[model samples]
Target: MGIVEMNKDGNFPNVRLLFDNDTGIDDALALAYLCACDHVQIEALTSTPGNVDVEQVAANNRALLALCERPEVPILIGAQDPLQIPLVTTPETHGPQGVGYATLPDRGTTASSEADAVDYWIDAARANPGELTVLLTAPLTNFALALRREPRLPWLLRKVVIMGGAFYYQGNTTPTAEWNTHVDPHAAKEVFAAYTAAAEQGLESEKLPIVCSLDTTERFEMQPEFLTRLAEEAGCTESELVLASDPEGTLSNSSNPLVRYLSDALRFYFEFHRHYDQGYIAHVHDYFAAGVAAGTLGYQSRPATVDVETESTLLFGTTVADYRGLWGKPANARIVSSNDPESGFAELLTRLGALARKLDTNS
Candidate 1:
């Protein structure tokens, strides 16, 4: 069964989502999950530099879309670098090409649409006022820029979902920051500031950005056995065994291509986590964020005023959430407080497995 019970009727929620991502391994999984869902309507994809460079990130997005047989969606490239910071990519985490060991198919004719991502953000919001939900799984570069160009975005769009920040939780990028926010602390600061301004201007609470911080996102960890089960669900002839005890860099020999791609990609992630002593499981962060954006994941959120520290040398990218109204600012974000990662991952596997089965049968 899907997350929303209404989805059984076949035409309940027409989630019009605009994805803004850095196109890393987790980002690829997030997009693939949405592609598998029949109800989610992915309008466009915008690329931002984080796990890799802008050009590479755009390429990865096109390749993942093509791999899922979704080439119609236009990809828009954002600023090459953050608003104010040196761009640093984690090749060690996501591999040099940013998609781990998985190889993507050609992006057919072109890579991106003519629309500037920042401009597209403003135009798309104005064209479909209160009808589009923007999903940001990367640094808030394009969003901050868009807010700068169009100050009314907070009220114009239906909603905004962000997969960044650590709040009072442990940071993945630094001692006090998360990866997406750490990449562009200035941009994140500006984005939060924009929402605070909008809240002061009477922006509805429902329209506030839903933030999926690392605390909740880290709960959706991916194990090697999950890939094996996914392969079986995809109707693969061979058993997909990506055991950490086995030789490192072991590739999948599954008959299904989707299974192969996911296995190979996730194996690298598994290895990376093991190297960092986080176990052999991969923390599928963006997948949970994608689920939250689609409204298919059951979660509870609390209103908080979020801000990023961009100046402190020791805590440059730290994200702080004020739940006590101590900052005297209206809440700008609805921070995800709790969720069931088990059911969320189960939902993801079911959807992706069904999609993979359908693709192989159709092909």
Candidate 2:
């Protein structure tokens, strides 16, 4: 089969996601979470050069899908560079291959004939009408291209859940901007303004198009034992494997290729957590964003007159305006701040076990 065969309804869900990944540990974790979730049907994946090169990002994506036993899923290669600015990468944070020290498989074949990611997105949105949700995790280049192809897209998409921007939160890339949004501020502005204006017009689809400068994913942290369990169940039970992807001590720019390889790198990725953030493991931020895309989690949202200030000295990029009082403007996006992490993670680990067994048998 084809993606169509996997669609539960006659048509795919409005939840069409686009990932311009750096191939970091969270990206892999997010991809695995999306694949394992039955509710979220990924229609397409698009890679960009941010943390890892475009080729490696694509390769990592392939290895991940194969590891999940869903290589048949379609993917489209994305732009080699950013929309307007020079490519900025973070090898120190995302590691050499973009994940924790992990291994990747060979790239076999293109999963889709729609090679141009922007065109693929445009066609998908047009074909699906008001049912296409664009979940962007990395940058906004692909989204900008899509809008350039069809100006009405901001109004047409079911929603756009973006995992970018830094509000009161300190920036991971710089003092004021987040990596994803800062990479392409022009594209971010277009997307932000388009969706904001559309919601002001009471467009139904715009009611949830723009999720703001929010990162609610800090709530979902997996325990060190959980990471050990995932690797152990994966048959790589050595404590070394656990230490490698520890999310703490694992250097973002490890020289050992196999240390951050996607296949067995989860340990080092987890180890990095022990060094940077609190505890031995980091929260699943992007993965939780994927959960919102799957509709598996609940959200509480309020409408506001949102704007991106192009002139803030500190926030040289755009900044969403202070939450204004109740206006007729619709809610183009939602923010999910909490979840049953214990139960949800347990469910995810359980599914991983089944998937691991399936891969083992097939191998």
Candidate 3:
């Protein structure tokens, strides 16, 4: 099928994205962008133990959705650790309690007690069959397990857009790999093989998965003016909203302004990155993945046999593709081709600002 066009009524394809997060700032930004889209319908979210604890991730998802006035969205907690490797979280980047140490509002949103991330994914895919697109923004462990449990998942899936694995760009987590895939190399290997097989068999249309790695997303940065405007439109000081989004505020009973600001601003990610890997203010990677899923960001795919090397510490968890002579498939995944981040951020500001204006007028 071609692009799922939004009808006159503004209804688009029903999407079921399974998130494996630890409540990082970019995750919140991505969730906000997803909720803002008019066509895409989010079916559910499954949190994992990557950036923070599973509980904290689930809470952050609910809290952010609530802030967006989308409390109807359901959140489910997923695996506490990867399928193989011991979980290594980036506390400095997301703060101690995830969510960049933002103070979250007192919203008693309950989480679904799914068997596991894998089970939840399997059931959702089986239920939706051939209509659901699985956008994995974190590790592929949950997805790999789900596929193992239900080997026919690819047959049911419409597409699988992942946000892991570095090809042409330097890795954020290591010299050869992205964090999500790096966390569970075994799972990543299985998932890559499964999807590649599906594509070769013509089970899925987009054989080459859309990967919004650091190389592309790092280019899209947030302008300070946009943050200032968002703070103004929210009818509260940016400091206040940031405070409300903090997880530690509820858990540790402490408050910090820098933490709160970091919780909401994707630009501040560099502060943590510099400490961990000598990185700087990168774009909101996951949110841009959502943008691609929504068909706004364009991407070109090169068809090649891709695999994840789970062995060799130097190459472990790294994804590599053999594209010696084959021309890869063209895709709609928009890898930012050196555009003005300030301009791109301005578009976001204007779009959200217009939305705010329309809401105010109706009120």
Candidate 4:
């Protein structure tokens, strides 16, 4: 089942959220979507090393939050390296700065939260047990560490929506692994084991973790035409003008900061996909993960005993879903198989357009 059901008014309720990100292009876009959405109250942001170093990710988080006018949200720095393996970064996909072509304005002297990320996570869980949902859009290093500090963390969290792994689809990092999981397969393994242990100890099935793997996420692609239509609907004059002049380079000279930033960031992602997958579009992987966290997306899910491969050299980091119950273990996670992409994309654009309108007027 999904994280939440619709209310009598057919609307999802506002949810409190904690975000952990590596701040890549898609992560930035997801953050923008979450900040703009009224249905989620972002409690805090935690940074980890993945797309770039932890330091750069933290900086990107601060800058992006400032741009979204959400600098008040606590930014906490977390694991700088993986639990066991040396940290690997993907600067090639996301520009040298890890946020694509867009250069976010300096956030000045603003600093991140003094509280350690692990400490903050434990405290947040204690403060709002069974109420805080976590959106993990990066490696599982920080989360694994948090669980180590407080073994009861899985039981304390209301839900977890992970944007990692590749079950049925080909891996983006290696022949059998996704980037986030591959970056720190040991951590991923530990995390899955923790949840499995929690379930064995009698945590409710509904509270089990949910994963949005590459198989489902790769289905939602953002086309240029859709983005242009959204810009027009949002009345983004700058974006419209840019789209008119250089439709392909809509990121250049757009008056709408959000449009300009997102367009620029997406350009790099689009180019990567076009080169690798022969598609002139970008996948909304992390964005869909955020939607799941917000309980605003319709999807099909199956409960399964999931694990990460950490021992095999070639297949390390591969997400193994025991569909046949060969392991004879109780299900520990919900694997999302498919989603209503059309309606989901529509809702995404509607919310983004509303944010654009708000930013346009405020600017």
Candidate 5:
């Protein structure tokens, strides 16, 4: 199949998205944004261990989908642990439940797809061929496993968007590594190498892979005032309206459940960041990666040979990019260097808010 062309409305084409996430607060926010947007059609959601365990990730995905009234999208459980290391979680940052203090209704007995995550990814790619965009927001274990099982996965994908790494910004895990890569350096290394090899063997450069590093994502900070505006514009005083009740029967004329859920979820994230980064703001890092895949966010990127350090005792998981051809390797990834967070945030809020109103009116 060829590229999924945009319709006459000049909006994004209905991109088929397969998301692999840890389902942390940020991931939840990203999911809400994705679900609210009209440009992409989510295919499946696969879980991994990062902010929480894989099981909890799946549960969160299911619960959030239920709240969004989109439980039709399948959830698939992924690797229980990293490829060569013990699983580590960041409960401190994302709270014990992985979504901060906000609790989602338990999707009791809500099961994921029986197929292994690796198999699901490979099969999805084969079915969609050149029309699948894979958004990876967690550790790369599933992706590595899938790539190993099927070497043609890279070429089959329309694009791969990674929400990890830090090219120039300080790392959030180690002084030199980001959390996602730090939790699974071996998997990250394997994925970079696989994409690099695929491109060197003749895959188109544009379809190689895109990395939304901390350098760019750290600039995106969700402000409380923005949330306030959303609430006020939606005719609600408190941002917790959507969080206070089940969305199915909630008065859709009041506010959007998507916006309410995001607002409620961000409270804990905002507090965490306030203490962690001395800023009372939440960074929805993964949202930019999704926007990049959707062609809604403009980014400045450059071709680079990006690699992850898997064995440096103190610097394990550090993203090493050969920006100057220092290692004499061809560029394999497009490292996003900059993006207008203000414009991006504006677009996200506008689109999501409009979606909420539409859903409300329909409801």
Candidate 6:
């Protein structure tokens, strides 16, 4: 299927994206990467509660958009808590504010009280069928609710890229579950089941969701040197230095605002990883997901009949993928199996650095 649309003047193809995330450090990086890309038009942002609370997530998104000079983009708050589960915010992982140590500029509320995220998804899909790609970097809460209201979502949108699950890999949240799915495994299960139902209704297998599980996403690591290179690319007089030897919660003092914001954010991530003995590097899970959604990164995937385990007490949120034909089920997702981390990081640095340089020039 043609994922992008050509301009009316026959110039070039462009992508229209609807972004959903919880606005953690990696999610912020992902959003920044998308904001930097010149070929994609961000239609709107929908915030969900995961890394932090819903209100804080919306504030973080609005602040990031303002920093990117796209504050006019609409933002809607998603489900307050995961269905059938209490809300669990990870301040330990993402700091109290969910953006690590970075400070947000626009702290005003952007949560649309009257508007609902599920309605937004359904309406957007109905209005722009075959022209919208949804990048969901959070729990499957909102999208799952939308699929309940509109079961044809599997065939309505061009693509659905999700950043969750940990098939055949160690989880970051639990021994068998990723954070996003752990927060709302029931929602995930419903999403996959809906897709399976749609497949039975003649939705092509290629239209299934693309799953960016932790097994592949963890490959995209972010070293501190990348930030230094990005600062230099943005023509900052001060190099962005985030040494592991520095104290916890160190801040960035780069000349460029974008570099400084990112430096502060990634510094906390480096510290978090180091605290857990995972080295001073950050596993940029959502940035890879963002690249996958943007169609700017190369990856290999295999079709899998995916399911979520919600009833097991010991395995509360485990994601099970039937790679073999033993399940006798239609494939519900394309599990990303492999990716090149070196090239992914390079692409992120180049695009974000260019945007930073442009912003600096305009300022």
Clashes of each: 0, 44, 19, 0, 0, 0
- What do the candidate models score in CA lDDT, each in turn? 0.87, 0.60, 0.62, 0.83, 0.81, 0.87
Off by over 4 Å in 6: 1-12
Write down the TM-score for model 3: 0.78
Clashes of 5: 0
Q: What residue runs in model 4 are displaced by over 4 Å at the alpha carbon?
A: 1-10, 108-115, 238-251
Candidate 2 stretches with Cα past 4 Å from truth are 1-20, 109-115, 210-215, 231-263, 277-279, 309-313, 325-332
The residue ranges of model 1 lying beyond 4 angstroms of the native Cα positions read 1-12, 112-115
The estimated TM-scores of all candidates read 0.95, 0.79, 0.78, 0.93, 0.90, 0.95
lDDT of 1 by residue, 12-109 (tens): 47789999999899999999999998888898899999999988998888887877888888898888899888999999999999888988675554
Which run of 10 residues does model 1 get worst, by summed lDDT? 1-10
**Cα-based lDDT at residue 59, candidate 3:** 84
TM-score of 5: 0.90
Give the lDDT of residue 47 in candidate 4.
91
The lDDT, on a scale of 0 to 1, for candidate 1 is 0.87
lDDT (tens digit, per residue) of candidate 3 on 189-278: 887677666665665445345666666677776533455465454443333232223342332211322223333444445455555554
lDDT per residue (tens digit) for residues 203-246 in model 2: 66334544524444555776656654554555543432344333
